[model samples]
Target: MSKPRSLDKSTKEDVSFIDRQPDQLTNQSVGQAEPEVPTGSDCAIAQQSSTQNINALPVDVLPPRLQEIINEANICLGFPKDYLAGAMLTAMAAVIGNTHTAEIMPGWKEYAILFTALVGSPGTNKSHPLSFAMQPLIDFDAEQAAIFNEAMKRYEAAMELPPKDRAAKGYDTNPIEPKRVRFTMQDVTPEAVHRILSENRRGLVLVSDELAGWFKNFNRYNNGSESEFWMSVFNHKAAMSDRKSSQSGVFIRNPFLCVIGTIQPKVLTELAAGNRNANGFMERILYVFPSVQSKVRWNRERKSPSFDIAAAWREILSRLIGIVPAVDSCGEIIPEDVPFSPEALDRLFSWQNEVTDRCNAEGSDTLTSIASKLEIYAVRFSLLLALADRACGDEKKLIDADIVERAIRLTEYFRVTAAKVQGIVSEDALTELQLAVLSELPGTFTTAEGVAIAAKCGMSERSFKRFIKDRKGVLFVHSAHGNYTKL
Candidate 1:
């Protein structure tokens, strides 16, 4: 394995920065994180201590099995909600999302498409939760690969036959083109995604353990189409890619793409300053940054849970998979539109009107977009909940008032968390600039090394020190000597 980089000679220790996960949203789900278990009394005490900021949605926000998955992951890997909740959201998106399973209201059809970002520093055990949650999907893809390869062999054999023999064998040009069987695409190009979308009428997902790179290269093609495509797909609008170079291209009348991943807080600080996400990218996401664990509890004698969390995950997903995605006579996926129950419709429209009036009163773009979409997300969340509850044997899929109530609560939780993300990322340009400098430095950097890198940004040594000094317990945790680490 390669050694971690250092800043200078004689500084033997490492200096770390950007502890939070970066802007990776699309993908399959599974993750683990450390948990700060607080009793009701402890919570009360904490609240009495100050106006406590609960940075995460409570564990109960997730479904029972999903909650169990997150809990077991925490016990095993110490992943926090910052990681696991996003993974659970991803798990929901992947299982129920691609299928035209159910919908929300009239003329407003939507799948369970959700984008989640786990915001935390590295070493907090962020990636594992997502890995654990997405393991089932990953396994399913691997299983499908064998099927795809067999089809490819048949397709190639058919292509190579003589014209008469091929006609007799019912072979056509480009026959049996390998179906778009894969689901997860990580840090890939737009054309590659277009190809996947073309073949997989069900849709595709984008997932990354580390999201910083994805956001950095998001606009790499320099074409505005990527941005436009992302915006359009958020609403399940029909889209197609017209690639040159003798490609037949791909089209999907109903495109459902879900994004989820982790991002470093420092990278996000720099990234939030850019205008890339202003065009509905960030607006569509349910951003979350659960506060770090207040204490690390280690029981040397504690035995690891023997239960198979992945198996349990697969069992739930297997049921969802049994509910086949709708397909057309042309073998394309036909989405099943779900209407709101009388009670659900009443509650949803009440929420819509309330939010519309509130946003109009507030006159905030962010709030307006958030309020509008959160209600829509509520619908999606309700459908997912109703479907899961039914498929798992509780009852048949029914969008009811109870589901709507829970959906609203979940959306409320995400709204608070997203505000926390936007507040930090959008504010403090100097801090963002400083974060950029730290990101460039080796994890452990000497004062001279830091000065040299900061100077490239037109920052003088004194100015840099002044900047770091002011950011004491806020953005940084000062280390010994001239070294520092991101908090």
Candidate 2:
């Protein structure tokens, strides 16, 4: 095992784990495009594509229980394993919330939080896997809602009584409404999210089925204030906001938010809107975009897994939720520090040095920004993986070398996928003629076929070859000897 390759360079090594290809789109199901149910051939394509590309998620880096869940979900629900794995990672971070942090040194600490997006075409089964991963948090919020509703009824009944009567009825003359405890929020406003975060210090996860709206709503309220709020929360920094509706401003000492959502490949341009690309917002996101082949026909005969995936996932998250966070005298959460062992720290330092060197050597700002974020993510991932192992009964006290090694592998997987997303975003920079030529080409074609298609667009063979060669990872990915695929 050699160390993971530099982010600036592509690796030719044969990695074992299989994931979808990056940026390639399969045909949409005719009319009313419904959910895609992947068949055995989907797995075959995944296995074959892993040999040719490094964009796939390294599923083996995950914990054993999570591995089982991904396998069972794919077999039973036909959800893409890549999507499930990515969603599960975000789910775990949300569950961890602000309870724990990975302390790299005296001053540097990272929380287990992430902003992830699952990018795919329609009917690729992105939503289902995400729903499956986040069901536990949803269930927890539902329970809280029920509790709040009952308390509100009591409060309302008590409020109907006169001041003296209320006291006689064992109710306070003045009543404070019970604050709702929510672990997950969807389709919410920025101020609403801030108010909720102020009430519930555990933090919140924003789960959106379509992230296009998330981008579109960036400057909706106060001209980039919402975007700045999100960027601050991404770093777990202190957040304070004062609005006209509130007498007192809302303040959070350590604001934590983990966002997970899905968007189509064509929506990548929205990411660049509002200067998100020019800023660090685009780099903070981790994208799961699997290259896929044709959709598999629905198989009614596919059997469900013997073990219950939902129950297993619930149990795992429940264990994590049960871990109580330490609080200071001021009633603020004090994140429990999980430091790396000597060996693990050494391994982490080595990986960070390599990433730093790669960032220094790379010219592409997109890739460099991604590498820098992944450096922080590397520590966050190690903490999450270690705690997840504990939730699974590993009982490890400190982050070990093996866990750090796994985190490095996991970080590399995201590094590749983020590059793929950058490639998709770069397509927005394509000229009209290039976009026209790409729209005309097949999903996969030979060089001769590409030349013929280019000629149809009135492009010469020399120019066509130059276009293909220059846009190797962006507009197209070289498939084989003289073969290319539109990305």
Candidate 3:
């Protein structure tokens, strides 16, 4: 392959300035200063004082057999052993903090976007993980799960609920009925989303497969109020007005609900740039891109476990709901000595700065938007980590550098990979141009011939020459005859 092209003159100059004055470029840290750890006595006192009715269901009460099954199933689902521990810890934290509520409430987390995309080739069981593997963690009961499934079906059918006849006797008049509604895998409308949140108050986990398909629809309707509605729901704090009795002027807030979506990488690329969906909306999501290599294919020749692991997991998760921590709000439980190193913090901030600068320079507003989304994801992940630690009976609420490192790396991979797919950098185009020129001209060529070759490759002579020069080591003078030769 041809050598990679260097940055343009202006970009090179900017890079030089950065290299010469690294302190000037990244003088500040991205997040707040690490808090000091509390003493054991302090933690105990704090836990006793602020203890709420969060843990209605205690894990100690769970049967050992069930616990073992849960552990084994989690492993089967391909979750790393460490992450499984983290998940348990997260559940424990939620139980301790507000047993009734998950600490990472959608809007309360302060993420710019709440987006989650699962990417892999077709039939990689991508959607199954979100729907079956993770869904049960939310703890939907049989009846509630049935209702959720139906809601998805109705959503897919595009069958709007018939307008209620308020005057009819024996007809339920409740504005939001407790009906099991499943969203159509295809039709993800603003109205449908609004209804799902409004009716499913106990918290609903909306899962969709082939996200690229829905993303296309999102783009088609990404104008006017439709887009606004989508953004408002994601804001988490925003409440939707009652569609059915505006005269009553009632508004409802959805606190417990969350969305988990799965999609292929190609679909994500299309949705990220092709659609006019604001970067702000995209940034609010916790993107989990599943690896294709990790997919477990089932065939007739090979039999795998067909047990309802989701059902089992849901039971475990349901037990965690409404469990709040019994700790003081101000008291910090993390050990100060175990905090992330200054160097780790520095690296994180540097990465954030790099992402911000690149997004700004590329004029891709989504880059900055994703940065905000990533911050929320990081915080949520941290909170989960803290909760998991506390659940494991660890006294500290502070997460170590390893957790932060993993979160940052995950966010960066998604952002950088997405940006590349969208062709945000000129590197791809330049590389293609260079390859084309090399392929056509095997020997030295005059300026006129070079321009002709460039024209044939569908680029302007100016652009072609600039690429040649910017590429540096690849181009050389042939006897200074206003001709160039491949080095």
Ranking by lDDT: 2, 1, 3
* Candidate 3 C-alpha lDDT tens digits along 1-487: 1111222333222211001110011101112122222222112211211111010111211233333433454335433222232233323322222122222332343321234555455554544334444444444345456776776664543324444644253333444323653211224565565555555443344445555554555544424444445556555455665444234333444333344455555455455553333445555544443222234433344323356655555555554443433433542221112244454455455655665664454333434555566655554444444343343334544444444444443344344333233332223334676667767874556778878988998879888767655532213323243655443
> CA lDDT of each candidate?
0.61, 0.76, 0.41
lDDT (10s digit) by residue, model 2, range 25-124? 1222222233333333223322332423424566766778877878777766677777888898898898788999899999989998899999888778
Determine which window of 10 residues in candidate 3 has minimal summed lDDT: 17-26
Where does candidate 3 stray beyond 4 Å? 1-113, 135-141, 144-189, 199-203, 216-224, 241-257, 265-274, 277-316, 324-369, 390-395, 398-402, 420-456, 461-487
Assess every candidate by TM-score: 0.73, 0.80, 0.51
> Candidate 1: which stretches are off by over 4 Å?
1-52, 101-104, 166-175, 293-299, 430-487
Write candidate 1's Cα lDDT for 1-487 as tens digits: 1111212321111101111111112111223243333333112211211211433454554456666666666666565645676676667676666565455544556688877777766555567778877777787888888988898888889878875688678777447567748667787778887777666666567887777766666566645567668768888888887767327767777777887788877777655534653655676777666655333354465446668877777887778766676677987776665556888778766766766775565345655665666777777777776666655455544677656665665666566555556546544554667767756765445677778989997778998877655543233334455665443
Clashes (backbone N, CA, C under 3 Å), per candidate, total 42, 1, 41
* Candidate 3 lDDT score at position 198: 53
Better of 2 and 3 by lDDT: 2
What CA RMSD would you report for each candidate? Answer: 12.7, 7.4, 16.4
